[model samples]
Target: MSRRFSPSNLFLGSLFVLAAFSFDQLTKTIIADIVMQPPRVIVITGFLNIILSYNEGVSFGLFSEILRGRPEILVFTSSVIVAGLLVWMSIAGGRLEAAGLGLMAGGASGNIFDRMERGKVTDFIDFHLAEWHWPAFNLADVAIVVGALILVSGSFLSPQQDVIGK
Candidate 1:
């Protein structure tokens, strides 16, 4: 069967992506508004907790300083780049890649929306060592990571199989 781009595929893929985005945004809003200060951690162990936080950074709190404090340049640049990626994913990236692209696009869009609306992305999940802590992350971060992993793994998996003595 030939794999071809189709409007139906794009629409379905976009729907999944948008659904993920909506869920992430909805969760963040609930945490931000309903959750109390220090955000009632649901302790799983010494290493993990669900505590509300605001992350003004690229993934894992990188470039947080750029996101925080400064308002114009970095935010605008990030927004534009992410928006471009979403457009590309919507228009291109056929069925196999659609889920991954949708995930990445939706996640980036969700986080960008958060930053634009609240000036920071709401983060809650946290893990730590005795003295060290991983950066707080949220649903969007999870989606991005999962999508990236899938894309990378798929790249490795979907190659031509070499055969000998046909």
Candidate 2:
């Protein structure tokens, strides 16, 4: 096997993937099925609330109208993206890159699993300032964003030769 796909690399990457996926799924289950049984808005702080929402589309509810009731398409698209992430992770040059890719893959997988089983993604984390509120999102979304940020920041911090394996 290639150096990038060494046992240690793959194990570390897989560990992140499993951790992200498990945590995302566990949080979703607890919030959706247990805490929000009655499905009411729960205010935790001045700026945050738990409001159960089902997102039928991609980020910010975009394409929800088109994607609603058509989860198969979303599932297919998301699966493709996850597969690509897995391939990238397998060949990642550094541990940081692999970890980031794994997180993205795991987050995507969580949402895809939701689409397949629930026909939509459950979102509950709500942040607001004054009257304006950001779109509600779940742990998976957080993981994806954090992973992307890590990858971007890593690129800037690491030497080009190290990242590119030159």
How many residue pairs clash in model 1? 0
Give the clash count for model 2.
0
Q: Which structure among the candidates has the greatest TM-score?
A: 2
Instruction: Give lDDT tens digits, candidate 1, residues 1-166.
Output: 2345557546755875797799898888777677645558777799988788887777777788766765455468767876765565555434545566677777877887877777777898788998798988888888777767756665554323211111
Q: lDDT tens digits, residues 55-138, model 2?
A: 999999999999889999989999999998888888876777778888888898889999988999999999999899999999
Compared with the true structure, all predictions reach lDDT values of 0.70, 0.86
- Residue 9 error for model 1, in Å? 3.0
Pairs of residues at least 3 apart in sequence or in different chains that clash in candidate 2: none
